[model samples]
Target: MEMVERYIYAVTQRLPQGQRIDIAEELRGLIEDMLEERNDGRPVENTDIERVLIELGSPAELAEEYRGTSRFLVGPDLFPAYLSVMKMVLIITVSAMGIIFAVETILTPMSILHHFVDLLISLFVTATQVFAWITAGFAAAQYFGVAPPGLSGGYNRKNWNPSELPPVPDKKKQIKRGDVLTGIIFSILLLVLVRFSNHLFGVLLFEDHHLEATIPFLNEEKLLELMPLIYLMVAIGIVKEISKLMAGRWTKNLAIANLVINGAIFLLAMFILRDQAILNPDFVQQLSDSWGISKQQEEYTTIKTVWKLSYNLALAAFVITLLIDTVTGFYKAFRK
Candidate 1:
């Protein structure tokens, strides 16, 4: 009876929301009828139930039968997840743009309608890109036979047995929705800032609360040359989040993939950061002049030394964070 319930859940959970209830009822009746016929005046055993379910086919296959002829780009198996991720990405993108719009409105003199129109255009363009990337990521996963937990998501083979069903993931080990949402938003926000406004990471000098000067941290020309590497890092981050979303829980393969992805990012960042030419050498000289320090003085030298070391500090900090995330992922995945 417990197996019976588990089998029913495995089937119905894969279906579209509107059809789940009715299909569950229909599948339940079908299973019962099959069991009765198999009973043959003898006591129905566990073997009897297993045989019946196996004959009825895998939950994924049964769910497909219930869905009937039509096919979907994401397919019914992944449509729910695809839809969920799509909504979050789109909402986060619009909200991020809206906040940027609000700030732009306050900082600069522009017609409200002008800003609003710009927001609309940016939203349309960004949303289209987001929608396409998300759809492609999910489709790629499905095409490659990677699936999330539960209904129609385990191993892909000609024979999918009831026993082969993946165990219900522990919540502690599961990929939390909060985490996935937060990761997606932050990743998108960070990408936007780096791609369009890297200059924002700099000192903004003010005079009597009125803006005066900006001392940019990075050499814009050098950064422009390195934009491809930066984009690569962001792209890797997006893929990592997508993998986490589809995995639905920690796993050995996921932990390893996480380590590899994080490691690649760290290496790429360090590669970029170690090239001190990418940093604005003018930053230290300009600040030193503001402090009234002469070029021949020890103070100026010390300031410059510390300025260069900042990149090293950033690289070290990133490595530590990477290790923490990777180790935590493995612990969660393998814990009893």
Candidate 2:
């Protein structure tokens, strides 16, 4: 029957590839036998097949039973915890990646169409990687019989302690996952951009619907020199974001971690910005030429000076913003 075939397909699809054909055949035979018994030796029809399948239950459940393992990628005992953690990781990862992408698009001048295409590809790849890794981590934990932290003895009443319960989190003081995710994404993208600026940071010019020129803005040597510190900062940022996501609200520990990360970032930013040779000379020359500054000697010097000043000012503004955020977090975390 068509229903029989469809039902068999559903069950077999959940099974291992090698087992599908044999399992499907066996399941079909059982269904036919059951239908014959139900129909009193009459021919089985699609409705009979449907009735048989309904009595047997869902395909996934039947497949699992046939496999002789009650366990899933995540067992029932750990499912609640798994779900929570999975949601947090997914939200953080997606949010962070999105923020980084937006920042990259804004900071780096590029063709809108090209940037959108690049972003779509990057997001798809990154999202898939993040989801697979997070799911695998949880699945491995489930398989290993590892319990989620703070869920002692699997939600037993014996472990309850009213006195040990944390104070009610202030709703206004909640640490938003979206915000934390954005920060994490920003840090990660910054790390990647800084680490691979030579390849990624370039200006493309088009003329008559054809690419005319390309110019890179960063010196590879200088960027490479800052990789270690940049990596450290990025790692710290990721850790902080994860902590914030887990806590779900501002707390002293998270606030302190945020402060430390911000401080470290500020120091690194200062160090990186102080390098006079960090900017690619050729890029500057090209930019100057494009601005038509080379033709006016007096204007060239003044404009160059203004550009350098603006660069320092931008860095300063970033540091100041970090300081403000750190202070606000500290105050909110510690104050009544």
Candidate 3:
């Protein structure tokens, strides 16, 4: 009878979620009827259950019959997660690239058409890459015998309890896969930009139908020196975001991980910010020149003071937001 429950679980889990309860009940009745007919109302043992299961056939074959088809590249267990991840990645990547394209178009109206074409090409390339990598990862995971818990062999319907199921996330409080994917993309972009900050964050001067990168905000030497810490923080963030995406909801363990990663990031940021010479002197000088304010002038002094204040404020805001997020994660995971 225990094996019968497991057999039902194995089959019904592969069926549509909406049909699972009904099919499970029906299967139980049918199995009992068969056992009753066989044992003539005697107490059914494990041998009887095994024989009934063997007659009913393997769970996979039975599931296929219920599903009405055998066509699949990825098994039912992994397909939902695969589709969700692909959709999330495409949405985030396309939206981010579209925003950048829009900004470029606005900055240079004469090349709007050219930029639009470039945007299309960029979108296609990015989408293709994301799709390929996500699919490959899931495929590899599946091939290696890693799978979602209920989809494989371990789940037993008899052991299933309502309390063990995760709370149905309130629409307002839910952590969406798209959000996690967006975070991953943002972190990846940060890693890329920081690793090549001299090229990506430079002051752009447009002249004679061309754009020239004049100087960058961060000192090259200081930026390179900070790369080790920065890379570690960003790598941690990427892994955390990926874990959240796979989990598809907040849990106590994930909340703890989030808190730890956020704390590490904040500490690394503070260490980097403590260095006064992190910003390039030439960048400040160029800014002062552009604003027609001499280094000795009160206006230049005021500008520098404002810049420092803004930087500190931004850092404070970043830390506050991270803390708020970590707390919110815990609340979501632990709330009644």
Candidate 4:
């Protein structure tokens, strides 16, 4: 019956993936037996199925029985995504902070050591704020009855209809685990690389086969000042990918989400690269000098022109990547 299938879908959606199949089979058999006993092998009707379902109780109650417990905050439907998201955020945040700390210390060992306590405090404080915000967001989403498809979401759902059941996704539409994981890793790496570009990419000279002097290619203070904007971009990317992972499939909604996130990222990139001070003048001159060229030389002038256009170059790169990603995401999401 349609109602029986709806009830089964509801109950099974709230259960673990591994248990869903067995529980669905068990529920189907029990319902069949109940219907048989009720009508004495007479033609089954929606009325009979309704009565059986009523006896079995609401899907939530039945699922609670199966789970052997009740958990509303971060319930079964949201827990897996919640856990994976939390782990991803925490790991990336911690690793990024560690990279910054290492880079700062290498740049100025004594200075960083003097502010060691401050740095540690900042890391903990940032981590704590991130944790609280993520937990609160999930909690709010649950209370507000918002959730990904194929989930019970919240108690605000007054009815479970057979029509509400999600169709099994086709293989072409299914988002792969490797793809999601790789996207996340690449994003995290980019955030770190950009955040510490000044220290990571610098002019280096050696004397007697020993490292002698170095000049940072980018303006450290300027990049630090724009950290919040960079972080905002990273945050949007994380949300986009997390949604993809949860959806586990492509849809028009996913395509639209990808578009919005990509647009936002491009805007953020424009804002960040708008500041020309991000490149240090001293680094450019020093690099030119190392090549035995002065500012008046044609070669040095050409180098300066190229260096001054770093903003355009970086923005162009971002635009290209964003275009590719947006196009691919839309194509797959809307593929017939």
The most accurate candidate by TM-score is 1
Residue 79 alpha-carbon offset, candidate 4, angstroms: 5.1
State the lDDT at 1 in candidate 2: 81
Per-residue C-alpha lDDT of model 3 across residues 117-212, encoded as one tens digit per residue: 999999888888998888888777677756656433234345776666755666645678667777877886666666656655656656776654
- Tell me the spans in candidate 2 whose CA falls farther than 4 Å from its real position: 1-72, 88-132, 143-145, 148-157, 192-217, 281-284
lDDT of each: 0.79, 0.73, 0.77, 0.78
Q: List the residue pairs that clash in candidate 4.
A: none
Please identify which of the two predictions, 2 or 3, would achieve the higher lDDT against the true structure. 3
Question: After TM-score superposition, what is the CA distance of residue 40 in candidate 3 from its true location, in Å?
Answer: 46
Clashing pairs in 3: none
Superior by lDDT: candidate 3 or candidate 4: 4
> Which one is best on lDDT?
1
TM-scores of the models, in the given order? 0.64, 0.62, 0.62, 0.56
User: Candidate 3 at residue 191, lDDT?
Assistant: 69
Please give the range of 10 consecutive residues that has the lowest summed lDDT in model 3: 148-157
Task: List, residue by residue over 85-122, the lDDT tens digit for candidate 4.
Answer: 78777766776666667666665666876557766888
Can you tell me which runs of candidate 4 are displaced by over 4 Å?
Answer: 1-83, 86-159, 204-214, 305-313
